[model samples]
Target: MKFEVTILGSNSALPTTKRFPTAQVLNVLERFFLIDCGEGTQIQMKRFRLPMSRINHVLISHMHGDHIFGLIGLLSTFALQGRKSDLHIYGHSKLEKLIRFQLELLETKLDYEIFYHTIFGTNIQTLFEDDSLIVQSFPLKHGAMPCAGFLFKEKERLRTLKSDMLSFYNIPIKNRHGIKQGDDFICDDGEVIPNDKLTKDAPKVRSYAFCTDTAYLPKIVPIIAGVDLLYHEATFLKTEEKRAKKTYHSTAEQAGKIAAEAKVKKLLIGHFSARFDDLKEHLEEAKNIFPNTALAEDGKIFSVELDRD
Candidate 1:
């Protein structure tokens, strides 16, 4: 399965010429999971040629305007496109009421089922799951009423059979499926071939973490530990540590420290404050702690490939 993430918006509370707000899309195989739809998110998807129909699951971290202002527009576009696929939304309870109010006031009935799952207190709860992937949410220390960070992990696949062993034993195609599923097959000659001997190990699972608008909190270390890629909000520099605490935000260095402590493979820091024009210092600060740290820029795609089984 193919795994990738695209940054739609990376700005903080306001929109700049280069960056918007917080929004991203994680493409797991053919399906897309939209995370935190901010202002101009639909426009961003159009810019990247992403199939709007492919996105049926939307995960909102909080009720902030920058994180949800684009939802109404996106839903309206879905309606205009004559979509009939069911859409599942996971967020806080208030978001459900908010979306319902908008749809009621506009008198626009959706063409498909809209399932809403409200996540109350976060304690590494599984918000949504399926055969391909599982998504979990954890509480964040942001000043909002309630905020969360999401973790996406691809489901484990069955092991593959060895070509030499398959033909050597004259294994039928029907039996091949059983062998791939870790079942031992008996040959006509009565030769015993163990599943472990005939098949290689399964591919390592890949996971991505999305965290934003939070202060430096180590409580999430276990929830986001050892992620393949982590996108953490770094709205300020170390010099503004005081301001970061006051505003319930994190510095680039703090974000890097968390990434390093969590042992994540890579880290993408964003949510830049309006004070700085150049982000070289921010990158330098993060890299000082986590060597694989990168800056999150709008309209940029980060690709990740999983190992073969």
Candidate 2:
């Protein structure tokens, strides 16, 4: 069961020599979920060797051009590739209209169907779920536009049956599923074999949170508390705190503080402003507040695993 995030683009409002914009791909157990689609996202995906066919869901944080400008191009490319599976998009209600208008105006017809799930208002809500994972959306304070952040949580895994004990108990193959679900086994002699003795605890549930293009809001701490990995936007340095606040973006230090307050295992800061030529200052500012912080650079991959400690 692999869980990881690959950064496609990390720059803020503009594309730089190295950075594109805001885009990421969360690979949960081999299934790809795209988060944001800034300009050049397809190129970045190809550069990183990520297969476009694997991405079925797209999560847009906001309506900002830097955050979603690449969606049309990606979809068109998918069509050109003769994709047949439906693509699901989760975002602000207005996004549906915007995408439809663009596709219609361009007279672009795709072979696959597009399903839009509208996320309305600023409330915390569950956006998607399956037997293995759950995705929740929460509102972010991003000025006039309706913005959101996402939390991805893996479901509690089934316990692993002890191989030695299974043979000793002569457990039937058909009963494995029940035992993994925490059921006790009954022997031929009617002896009860405890579930704990027959199986080992499964891996701990892992979680990741994505927060970007928002101001410093402490209320989100409770929603994303104790996540394994947190990707928060650090669009500016502490020296430009006023500009960050004015634009409803977070400074590097501010993003670090949020990670500390949320008690997440690791923090990834990105969405860098194009004005800066280097990220040394941003990394320094964030690391000063949260030592576990890492810079989110394009093509970087972060794995999400259980925090053994």
Per-residue CA lDDT of candidate 1, range 35-74, in tens? 9998899999998788888898999998899899999899
RMSD of each: 1.6, 1.3
Worst 10 residues of 2 by lDDT: 300-309
Candidate 2: how many backbone clashes?
A: 0
Summed backbone clashes in each candidate are 0, 0
TM-score of each: 0.95, 0.97
Error of 1 at 160 (Å): 1.5
- Compared with the true structure, the alpha-carbon lDDT of candidate 1 equals 0.89
lDDT of 2 by residue, 1-309 (tens): 789999999999989979999999999999899999999999999999998998999999999999999999999999899999999999998889999999999998899999999888469888899999999999998999889999999998899889999998889999999999999999888999999999998888999999998999899999999999999999999999999899999999999999999999999999998998889999999889899999999999999765433
Which stretches in model 1 have alpha-carbon errors above 4 Å? none
Maximum-lDDT candidate: 2
Tell me, by TM-score, which candidate is best.
2
> What residue runs in model 2 are displaced by over 4 Å at the alpha carbon?
306-309
True-structure lDDT of candidate 2: 0.93
